[model samples]
Target: MTKKPRLAVLLGDPAGVGPEMGVKLLARAENRDAAELLLIAPPSVLAAGEKIAGTKLDVIALRPGDPLRFEAGRITHLVQPEPAGFAKLGECSVPAGQAVLQALTVATELAKHGAVQGILFAPLNKHSLRLAGMDEEDELRFMQQRFEVPGFTCEFNITDQLWTSRVTSHVPLREVADLITQESVGEAVHIIDKALRSAGIARPRIAVSGLNPHAGDGGSIGLEEIEVIAPAVERLKRDGLDASGPWSPDTVFIAARRGDFDAVVSMYHDQGQIAMKLMGFERGVTLHGGLPVPVATSASGSAFDIAGKGIARIDGLQHAFDLCVQIAARA
Candidate 1:
């Protein structure tokens, strides 16, 4: 008999569409049977989500004396810490942020200990996450600190069509210049290369997108192509990887879609994300690699703007879980 895969999931911000999305994912059979999934969440939080999403799932309390209800009825109850603050749905509250963080901390701990194969965090509100005392603006940064790894984050989107990333994310457009470096671009290339190979791509061809128009127009525009990106490509090629570019951003992605390469690495956040999202949109999944465990956060965030609408797109969440299962199998 094969042992079931285990995934520790965080029910992000009860106020957001996370609850609704979670409902849709758990309802699927592939998720229900292939793995043993444990949700690290508060009882009240889960209940609110269950009610709003209208999906029934087995809820096992992490805390003693915590409230729990199954699809048909409330099953066994356990005792748990009472989350403080207002349980306001569809709004940002300190309490909701704290709850989301609490669940994540627990889930990450489980993944770290190898209790679970992977850690899956649903969409999170960046501001709310910060209010939970995170000093960083994104989950990747927070996880990096929590795991004590530096310079190790790349978001991945997988749709019915394509997947990709940027060398820089979450920085201002004006700040893109100061951040692009040969070392940084090179690292992005190398990491993506490893990831593709691990996914079973052989000699994965990596295409790097230029920071400036027409790849610096032969230094007439900017030198990032010549100075920052090229050197990295050279190093990668010398390292025995099939890497190339500082290619023109305008046409490289189209070439990539036409089968020119396995993955197109870009200079900044939107450079890669724009195309990826356009292709993947609600279907793309964001991956967090180089952590203690292969953790994935949702492409969508706390949709406080649309909580309980029964309308949150769940392809991303489902993919997040599916990816978690795949990583767990590797582990």
Candidate 2:
């Protein structure tokens, strides 16, 4: 008999679509059958989600240090002691951020200690985390530091089975040029290739994008493509990773979408993000690639405007959860 993987599911920011989506995700019987889930959140938050979703669920409550047993189609809750302070529906508050931080901390700890094989969390509002006093620029950095993982880590934007990884993420446009070195480009290619294979692809084909317009038009527009990007592609090819690039950014995505490539290695954040979101904003899933344990969430954020209205789509979260389960089972 095949063993079901145990996954940590965190309810992100009670004020947003995370809670409701979490409810919608678990409400489906097929999702429950895919893995053994541990939902980490406060009781009040779950109650609010149930109210919004108009669905009731039974959870086995447990305290810290309790022995966990995996049951297909069942969920166990590690209830937070304090239930107060999460922001009301559709509003951002410090308490909401704090709750998200705490829940993520607990979930990461479980992964670190081998209690869980993968993690699936709902959408989080960056503003809420900043309000909660998060010093890091984003959750990925925080997770990396907390886990003490000493390797390349990246956020891979995936849609329609096509993946994109960036050479530099969350940096200013002015600083992007200087940061696009051979090492950075090579690392992005490496991670994206490994990530695609982990998702069940064999011998992934990768396309690398140029930093300048029209691939620098043979070094007339910019030298970054000639001096940095092209060289990186050649080195990656020598390493036998099935990589090719220095393609013009304008046409690379089009080529990949037409089945020419498996993944695209972008130079910066928006370079690939804008296109992926346009391809299928609602269906995109962001995998926290290069982590020892799989971690993922929606490529989009908490849609506060439509939150708690019982209309927030569960497509993205469903994809995230499904991918997490797939990766965990393989791991």
Candidate 3:
């Protein structure tokens, strides 16, 4: 029999619904059966999550520096001590940010050493991350820096039926056009194609979205489609990739949803995000592609308003875990 892939699962933020969602995800028999899970969080946080979720997990808890073991039918939790003055429920604070940083650091180290095959984290607050002193634009960049990945990397938003990636993310609208070069566009397409294939799609059909309205209408609206995007698509096609478009961003998802393409590469963040979230907000997953190891999280952010309400949905986290497992198993 094949060994199950070991995964490091982090409870996103102490003050958010991450702990509760982690508890709920682990309570399922099927999740436990699928992989050897290492649940990482503070003891206080896990207890609070069990209380909020009303579902206690059978976890073998370990402190820092303790030897790790993965037992059948049980989770192995690494106890991440809560920082002093950690934020209270639904509040963002430096202590909460420090704790999240610590957890991610440990998980990244494990992945670097090949101790874990994948990392699945719940929703985290960017505000808390910033408060904790993360200077990078986002956690994906932080991971890239920590792993020292020198090549192209991008965030992938996915649903059960469709996958989307962006050339430029977390940038202002005014700067997006200048950033959309043929090299950047080609990198986005190449990475998404590789990611989809890693997830078991043999030959992914990718549709590229244009930067301007109606894809520049043959250069009447903008020259980016004619000059940058079209040339990039042609270059990628000549390189033996099944890539097409400069498709109109407005209707790209319509074709993608109708089974026209396996994935869509967008010019900017909101172009793809708005469509994916609209299609399935509760089940969307954000995958950090081009990393040394598979890492995934729910597309949804830390819902501070709904923290500790016992009403946070687990569908997105579940999907994230499922996809992480798929990619990790392949790795």
Question: Over 4 Å off in model 2, which ranges?
Answer: 83-86
Please give the lDDT score for candidate 1: 0.73
RMSD of each: 3.4, 1.4, 1.1
What is the TM-score of each predicted model, taking all chains together?
Answer: 0.90, 0.96, 0.98
Model 1 stretches with alpha carbons more than 4 Å out? 64-82
Model 2 agreement with the true structure over 1-331: per-residue lDDT tens digits? 1677788998788889888989889888898889888999888888888888999877888887787765556688888755446487788888899888888889889999999999999999878888898887688877887898886789999897899999888878999999999998999999988888888999999999999889899989999988999899999999999998799999999999999999999999999999999999999999998777999998878889988898888888899999999999998
> For model 2, what is the C-alpha lDDT against the true structure?
0.88
Q: Per-residue lDDT for 1-331 in model 3, tens only?
A: 1688999999898899998898999999899999999998888888988999998899998888889998899999998877888579999999888888888999999999988999999888888989989998889998888888997899999987799999999888999999999999999999999999998898899999999999999899999999999999999999889999999999999999999999999999999999999999999999999999999999998898999999999999999999999889888
The alpha-carbon lDDT assigned to residue 107 of candidate 2 equals 89
- What tens-digit string does per-residue lDDT give for candidate 1 at 1-331? 1566667767777778886777667667667776776667677766766787787766555453333233322222232344787757677777777877776666666566666777777787877777768777577787777666777577665554345667888888998899888788777877777766655677788888899999999999988888878988899888998888989998898888888788888888777777877666687788875676778766766777788777788888887787777767765
Best by TM-score: 3
lDDT of 3: 0.92
Q: Could you tell me the C-alpha RMSD of candidate 2 in Å? A: 1.4
Clashes (N, CA, C under 3 Å) per candidate: 8, 0, 0
The residue pairs that clash in candidate 3, if any, are none
